[model samples]
Every structure is written in C-alpha cells, then in structure tokens.
Target: MSVTTKTDGAGDSALVFEQRIQDLCHDELFEQGTGSEVAYDLISNELLLDGSARLNLATFVTTWMPPPAGALMAKTADKNM
Candidate 1:
C-alpha cells in the first residue's frame, strides 16, 4: 500500500490509511525503515479497531473530550510537570 501523509489547516501532519496494513509483516524480516513502518501500522490499527471512542470504555478514564479540549489539557499537564 502507498503511504499517504495528510496536512491539516494548521499544517499538522497525519497519516492516511487506505487499508489495514500491519506495521510489521511477520512473513518478511525487518530492514531499517520497515520496522518503524510496521510499528506505526500496529499502533494505528489498535487505536482504530473499535468503531468510536464513545463506544469503547475499556480504559481507566473513558471521558471523551474534543480535540481542542484535549490539546488544552495536554498543555496544562505539561505546565504542572
């Protein structure tokens, strides 16, 4: 699969997944950049396996926040540290 990177209005980069591809292919051995690609694939798949964040409540804190709110919280957390 061809890897496509997306940029938001704010110029933040993100990955665009056309299909579910494992970051690491068990059949093939790892080579330099391939290993990292495999890892990214795995992480992306796991986070997106479920339909939506609201539907999944498996975490300790299932409270969902909008992206802006989450970003603000992340900044606040960083300041406290």
Candidate 2:
C-alpha cells in the first residue's frame, strides 16, 4: 500500500507517511526486534487510521500534555490499577 501526503497544506512535511514509516522501521532500534515489513505496515496503517496518539485521551499517562492538563485529568486517573 502507498500513502501520500501534501507538504504545503497540512502540517505534514515533504516526506510522505509511507517513507517516514520506512525510515523509522529501518532505524537500528526497531530493526533489532523480530518485527517485519508486514507488522510495520499493519501497525503504521492502524496508527494513521487512529490519528495522532497524542490526541488519544484514553491512554493519558503516555501522552505529553501541558502542566495544567494533569490537574484536569487528575480526577479520572487510575490510582488503584
């Protein structure tokens, strides 16, 4: 599957999503794992479909948000689990 992105319109840069994924998959860190092209494509496609991980509010701990954002999220935080 081929993925393309516009450079001038959105915040995306010249490098398309597929190229970026290829670059990331080629990185030494990820290459050391047993993951293959099929896995990469599946994961990357899912991420693209899911939009930005930073925008996902369900998994708040891993996201990078503003300092005040913590206070807002504090009430819903899972302290027991």
Best by TM-score: 2
After superposition, the stretches of candidate 2 with alpha carbons farther than 4 Å from their true spots are 1-35, 53-70, 74-81
List, residue by residue over 44-76, the lDDT tens digit for candidate 1. Answer: 777586456356443337378799977876787
Q: How many clashes in candidate 1?
A: 2
TM-score of model number 2 = 0.24
lDDT of 2 by residue, 1-81 (tens): 559632333322323444544434543464234334445555666668655546665666555778787777686555412
Look at candidate 2 and tell me the lDDT of residue 70.
70
Candidate 2 clashing pairs?
Answer: none
Model 1: clashing residue pairs?
23-38, 24-38
